[model samples]
Target: MEQNWDDLRLFLAVAREESLSGAGKLLRLDPATLGRRMARLEKSLQTVLFVKSPQGYALTEAGSDLMQRAERAEQAMRAATAGVPVQSDQLTGQIRVGAPDGAANYLLPQVCAAIAAENPGLDVQIVALPRVFNLSRREADMAIGVSAPTAGRLVVQKVTDYHLHLAAAESYLAQHPEVSAVTDLQGHRMVGYIPDMIFDRELDYLADLGVGRVALASNSVSVQVRMIQQGGGIGVAHDFSLAATPGVRRILTDAVSLKRAFYLIRHADDRRNARLAAFAEALAVGLRAETARLEAATAGQAAPKA
Candidate 1:
């Protein structure tokens, strides 16, 4: 049996997306055509590639095995078709980066914009979600996670250590009782993640505070920060985010400091792609620098003690 590069390409897409419709969107082909092509590929190889169901397509063991091989073939095809030097130079394709909303709103927009400016031909897409990305499903080419992942066929790199501090809008601080210390937080309205929706332990910023009430709560970092920016209530806010949220200021300067790290997560196999590797390196470096610079700017704000 013989196969072509296009056949392998189609198989890889279906395997990654786990649905003909999903693969069709990526390939700009209809699901029916994709289904027929998938059938032909399976017949040529004489193996069951995917188990189809009402829910969606699921890769069989044989399909998973072929996907791994096909990706390598795909890499070679790209490199051979165009001199690999194209990858070494300007990155000329789209890279989808999934990240938590805090980093997405406060950090990535600027950093990715800068990277895109540098690589004029590159298109950078940022996907902001509250939970861990499904990297195995190709939901994103890479992800920025608040904590390092311990298991998976993934490469995790520590991006940066960032700080968060209890903060409130200046207007809210002016209207409420002064909170000079952590002990003073009792009875004060708070803004925080909905306790049950906290996706990661590191994000449970208010867990230790023992605040009596959370007046405002949300799963989105952006929403929580915006709430504080709009004088909703006192809450822990990223130093980087505070720099951008002009109305909000850190309180209890000597207390309630939280440190967390960001990790750059990628598929282990993606490390072999020079273009992606270069972009990942650039992203990690830019993110670290941007986080530091913004945090420093926040620290320098004249009325940091809200």
Candidate 2:
């Protein structure tokens, strides 16, 4: 019996994600279906491809060998279509973008909207969850991230620097004793990332405030912003994200401003992809403008009308 070439695609995704659920999220397939397909693929090949364990799927020797050939085939497929000329006006297909919750909540919706407007055929899917985007698994076509990747066949570019500061709702500040300095933070309730759940070092804002713990904590930045909005407690917020919230007030602005840069990342294999390249260029332009807006907003100024 001949093997199904399409199974190779599923195999590759499982190999990269090391779990059916992760691959299913990217592929939009149910886990049971993925498992059945993997089983069928394995049977057709007359060899076991993976060893399933609680941690996830581990590739067997045959699977490892197949992965090498599958990669070569993937590269060839990319090369075959690499020369297809796609003008800016003719761009189409979905582009998944991954980013931290802060960026996703405040910046990407507008940026992606502009991209979609320019290319009506393009579909932009923004993955807002704050986790490492596995581009190798097609988890996202491109990603905006707080940290530049130190390894992987990825192309990374610094987008722009933005600011963060301890902030609180006006009501919260009015009720709590005024925070006059960093040390004063210890005397009041604080909302921040759960100390142990922080996946990236850049996200450890409580430590920046010299606090050992938070009165309330969440892994999501959007949740932190919401808690602050509800007067739950003072917390670190992105200047742009907090810009539109009327009641939020920057605390210790002069004494505690932290600057961070966002990086644009894409798989090296897709570097020449016309739609991806055009979308990235548009995203960069939009991000730069947003960065300026965030800077002005943080300094108590309004961004000039575009």
Candidate 3:
């Protein structure tokens, strides 16, 4: 008997939706056509796959047995067809990478530039999501997240660790002379990243400091940084991001150093894809170098006042 993969697609759809009409809607087929396909699939396999009921359809024992294998096949098929070739010597394909806004803004540009330089034809899609991407569902080929992965199928690697420091505009610091230590922070106004929006663990570290009242709260770190630059109030900022922005002065470096790791995550199967592998390698190198640069800058700034 000839195996029909298309029938498996129809079978999986009905099993997932649990109703012929619902499956038809999802597959953009009419109920009658979907019913015919399911019947054909059951007949071809010589098995009763589903039992119809008032609620809809429930998978038979045989169908339940096949569901896991079928879904895995479907996922593999999707990964195989997600993109296309772009050049001769290079493996050209599109890679979807999800990361927080801070990484998207500060870290990814250098990584992207490196990928473009090495493989000009490769297309990269960067999705800036506050939460982790669903790698199992193929929502993204790779992810750069602040937290380590708890999921089983993913391959996670630590990219780097960086410090977060309390900073303010030099003018603002000059004015708030009393705000030199953790205890003094309670006397001053403060701008902070909204509770739900901070991705780094450092935010919690700061919360433990028992600092001053928040004068303003926002979800965007960029907004928090802008408010600080305009001399709104002191806020926690990554040392790397603060390097280029002038007028920001680090406050109580000894009292407020927050450190956290950045993680690079990808599905194990995707590691074989040339484009994904290349991009991951490039990203790791670029981020490490950037972290080193930031560490050096921080070290220089830590030197005693001349």
lDDT of 3 by residue, 88-114 (tens): 656466777888777777677777877
Better of 1 and 3 by lDDT: 1
Question: Which stretches of model 1 miss by more than 4 angstroms?
Answer: 26-28, 43-48, 60-83, 304-306
lDDT minimum window of 10 residues, candidate 1: 79-88
Q: What C-alpha lDDT values do all the predictions have?
A: 0.88, 0.85, 0.76
Candidate 3 achieves a global lDDT of 0.76
Candidate ranking (TM-score, best to worst): 2, 1, 3
RMSD each, Å: 2.8, 3.6, 6.0
lDDT of 3 at 273: 62
- Comparing 2 and 3 by lDDT, which wins? 2
In candidate 2, what are the lDDT values of residues 1-306, reduced to their tens digit?
544557778888888898999888868899889999999888888999999999999999999998998887887778778778755565688888999888998888888887789788888899998788878778788999899998999999999999898889888987889788899988888899988889889888788668986989998999999999999998998888877777887878888988899999999998877667878888999998987886687568442232
lDDT of 1 at 196: 88
Can you give the TM-score per candidate against the true fold?
0.88, 0.90, 0.73
The parts of candidate 2 lying over 4 Å away from their true place are 1-5, 30-33, 53-56, 301-306
lDDT per residue, candidate 1, 5-70, as tens digits? 889988988988889999998788999999999998988899999999998999899998888888
Residue 92 CA displacement from its true place in model 1, Å: 1.7
